[model samples]
Target chain A: MQDKKQLITIKGTREGLTLFIDELCSFNEAIKELHDKIIKNKPKKDDPIVSVRIKLGNRYLEDDQDKQLTEIINQANGFKIDSIESEVIRKEDALKWKEDSKIKAINRIVRSGQVLEVKGDLLLIGDVNPGGKVVSTGNIYIMGNLYGIAHAGVDGDRNACIVASYMKPTQLRIADYISRAPDYESDGVYMECGLVDEGQDKIIIDRLQVLSNKRKELSRFERRVQNG
Target chain B: MGEAIVITSGKGGVGKTTTSANIGTALALMEKKVCLIDTDIGLRNLDVVMGLENRIIYDIVDVIEERCKLKQALIKDKRFDYLTLLPAAQTSDKTAVTTDGMKKIISELKQEYDYIIIDCPAGIEQGFQNAIAGADRAIVVTTPEKSSVRDADRIIGLIEKEDMKEPPRLIINRIRNHMMKSGDMIDIDDIVQLLSIDLIGVVIDDEEVIKASNKGEPVALHPNTKSSIAYRNIARRILGETVPLQSLEDEKGMFQKVKKFFGIRA
Candidate 1:
């Protein structure tokens, strides 16, 4: 039992449950150790277990090795594969990954007939004029006016929201729901954020000050399973 | 190698051909050896605009098809010894000239000339692709209308997506001062704000543009006409000269001056 605990260390992370496979052992021993550990520490009814992230730790596994590793993880009753990450990634690959998560700031007027897409939080330092669009999978912040379509939560994350300087969006969409304000020009030049309301399941624009404390700029959501 | 620039406009009739002819002529006037290529193929007008239609014995199609030498196909301008026009094939279509063929021709031209200006065919198609293929930079043209500005915006986006290291410059043409003063036209500041590209030059509405082109003479050759000066300023800016934009409004004559003195606005 002591050897089993040393070979496999499991813990909860912001990105769901993570299991560390100790590199001090053989592949079969590691798998056996992980299987025994999971069986003994089975998730209780209130633990809200969904999936698992396996840390391979400096080892880049081949396709067959990954398949064998996944089969062992599958043996644990409730958890499925979230992802497999090697901590000490190749130098070039690490740079590429850093680029993907970086906040892309486009410092020009988003003109009509132009569409800008970003992976994470987008900082458009210029106005999105009529007929232009700014779409992102995560949160979007516009330093200038948002006169056009601004859609956040494109990949259906309800927490994602859009903050615009003018707040008068032609059409605002967060996740699956869309909101249109014909009279937004009345409030005119105020800064606001568009978020999905948890109560009504509709999109609402609140004052920017209220939502400032809950921003997740670089960290994407860990995979979550639906409640049964 | 000389800089190769493609002149493009997504919508037709915003003066892409005229700009190419005048810019090339202006550069040659400044003593730079300039070659202008018309990639319009079947519907070519650049040769006619430059007044080199009758001198086209061998066309670009001939050089690309390996039937004639490059010098044989280039029509030398009689006015300026340094300017040359590579006429598009009148008898053939865009398919006659491949993008790779254009790159090869442009690379060869780089060794001989100081500037290689390509007059791209309107619209984003095979002809546009072939023209922009060999270009080191791009110059997008547009007029003062919603439709034209929208098209220019799209063209600018396409240019930015290209592998060229520098973003395309914008040239606003045919701006009418009276319409602008009357609030019926989109002004330069508004258009520049919407397009969000570098503004190289602006051309005012003048009859000299139409009359000069009819005689197969570019406005830049005239040098004294209002539109001619505008085109020259554009050329100077392209040569890295920072010439301020000239106002399109007409100066008040004696009668209007007297009216203004009498507290009556013209």
Candidate 2:
């Protein structure tokens, strides 16, 4: 019977030593364990191979966090990093890895000169101030005001729409069509949605509730398939 | 330690150079040794603004490339014993001044001058980054215009991420008391609220400022007009003196001027 390791799993491959941190333990604890283990294995005064590789399985490492981990390994026992294998485990075309399921949600105000781009659906819970921009390949949903520029359906998805609490934007683009806000737009704050008008093949703006009703029907179709 | 301050306005023609020259001259007048550096290389205007264009035998590029000693590149202000102007390179571009080079130059100047005011060029490009490289503090200058205020907002956001010792202060330059009164221009409170920073000073629009610039004299040299008072107050505030915003604080005088101009009998 083999006892399960708590912190990390070390495997000696033909290339070099590979260290895998346990997912259950905290990152700080794993880092400390890795440091102690490297120092403990610091072969006497001379070691031929004094480097190891760290493979982070299915974990996103921010720049600073990666820097910290590398610094920890470098400063201890003269062991340098051979390679950092950031295995994100992305499964292309798998059942669970649907491209349409990807959604980017941001909850802060986008100020001037700020650019927010997303590949799939995007949901913004804050305002997009003037000089800001939001670009997406799929639908865009803004819970707050849209005072900046927004472009949806960038990759020829005409069905994609942009919904915002206030639709006074510098410019709006859907699929191949583009629309600019009229100079004399009403000053009232109202929820609105922008989408392509199939009949005219032009982008148009209307109340957000109209688009929400359409979304409700689409979700209803999805729910019927799931129930069956 | 001496503070290396950069006076930056993201938009052009918003009075950053004017603020730098005034602040430097004011600090020097207070008996503090000051060095005014113009980092707007290739498009140098600080010397012309200070009326010291004829004294620039050596520019910032000369000192950085080791062609001349630091002191040789500095043009001393004839009016003040403690003030000097380090002119920018007129022919060389902003790339000539590297951030690391600026850090070294600023550190060397720190040993001599009590305050180093860098006149940053407009735009958040190489010039902006180079000027801010060694700054311990920042002074963001802006006007009441929408474009100016928007750029100022962006600059403040950049300044926040700059990891400086302290956040930058705001100076609303060229404020017309009349425009503000008639609601044609943004108010001080609105500008402050939008920029979201400490309001250090508010300078009123004075015709004398243009006259002073032509003569290579900073407005702070004189103590008469509202422009002069505003610049002097800014200097006092920079020297750790708590000065109120004279333009907004004394609304009685401005109100009377507005009323007199419009011929309102009340």
Candidate 3:
């Protein structure tokens, strides 16, 4: 038989090396080719460690397959797997991700002693009175006063934020960071937002304008140009 | 059928008992047959406030437990022919009565009365639940203090979740006019907006209210004091009559009275 077509390709990039696994081949064949490529590219003991990123083109790897791939790369000297990227995912996982990104809108007073929770982004149209709490897995946007506790990014999304028209919250939490309202209170003349500052690893309360800059992706609609 | 109104404040000493007594008397003075039910159980005081404590031959527990007839347990007010009091059991706790029992008693009273005002106890416990069980309307009493207002907010939330015909109205009690004017206390507007409920009335802090309560006579019986007029106005509003809210401004001293008499500010 003619030499089997190559099922895996390796290339060097500015960051490090990249391994491309062919999707059309059987998983067994692809893994064998990947193992061979790692052995061929193995460096000498004196050479510095080089990171390798694997790109699985339209190929989904189960947990076992992924672990096997990682073990093969680690067994080769001087190669560390930085990350694995894939363009395709299982339908159930894709649906779960979509569900987590949805925005849920609610209207009514979150009265005292009440706890309102959402799985994704929360859009509240009424006040969160003192002693009340609002929690969300994604972002929280309140069109009314927030006089109570608000916890966003309950699933540890540091990029999530809490925005309120009147932000006199007793306490705010984003990701794992918790912050109490400062003694010097906001007159609440303008809307405010609270988010985790990655640099400082603290929750920061700032004017609403900061949301536009920090969370530009919050605006889902794209502006279109008009043709006259 | 008569409507039952539960007067409650989740915090203690926010004037719930006083409001219930005065509102019941006010409604009676307006010739509406009114029955005031003291639901405090172990800490009964509406009878004392109504000045009918000594006349309590049978208490609400006696009526609910079938130890006495409902009519026998109800004590007619010494002053108003249309007003009556159903005092709570001083020896028993709130656990002595069930919501079903309270509802049965209230429904029986509703058949013969124009209004049944249930004086709820402080704390959202068994007493409060028993108080609101058979009510058709709710009136949440609160003071201008932050803690009291906060508790009122909580009570309002609980009351709204109930299937009452009308939303709970607010009665901001014991407002210190001078303190409010000096900005030392929360503003009436701020309390109203924060609670976000219809304000039935605001009773200014007046010593006469305590003196009247001590004498077992509701301040609503007195016609001239600011507290009295506030209660009467609240009573008229409950009667479906439009009554303007009285200003909480302190009564003018003699000098200012003379100045105003001469239309100085006009």
**Predicted candidate 2 versus true structure: per-residue lDDT over A1-228, tens digit per residue:** 256465767888777788887766678888888778877776665656567888787676767978999987777655668988765643653334345546689886666788888886789988777788998887888988787898887888777788897777888988788888787845634787888877877887887767756545333423322321
**Error in Å for residue A98 of model 3:** 2.4
Q: Tens digits of per-residue lDDT for model 3 on A1-228?
A: 468688888899988899888889999998887887778867999998999999999999999999999999999888889999888888997676666777899998888899999987899999999899999988999999999999999988787899998888999999888998668845553488999887888998888888888877677532111100
Best by DockQ: 3
Q: What value does DockQ give for candidate 3?
A: 0.61
What is the C-alpha lDDT profile of model 1 across A70-188, one tens digit per residue? 88777766777898877665677556555434578889777666889887568899888777899987678899888788888687777778888777677888878888877533555
Worst window of 10 by summed lDDT in candidate 1 chain A: A219-228
Per residue, candidate 1 scores C-alpha lDDT tens digits across B1-266 of 68899999999999999999999988998899999999999888998888888888999999999899998999999797899999999899888899899999999999999899999998888998899999999999999998888788777777777899698999999989989888789888888876777999998888888998999989899968878888888888888999999878798799999999999978
Q: Pick the candidate with the highest TM-score.
A: 3
Query: How far is B124's C-alpha from truth in model 3 (Å)?
Result: 1.3
Put down candidate 3 lDDT per residue, B1-266, tens digits, no spaces. 89999999999998999999999989999999999999999999999999998898999899888998999999999997899889999998889999999999999999999999999999998889999999999999999999998999999899988999989999999998889989889999999888899999999998999999999899999999999999999999999999999987776799988989998982
Q: Is the docking of candidate 3 incorrect, acceptable, medium or high quality?
A: medium
Native-referenced DockQ of model 1: 0.30
**Model 1 root mean square deviation, Cα atoms:** 7.3
After superposition, candidate 1 runs with Cα above 4 Å error: A1-116, A126-132, A145-148, A166-170, A179-190, A196-228
Candidate 2's TM-score:
0.68
Ranking by TM-score: 3, 1, 2
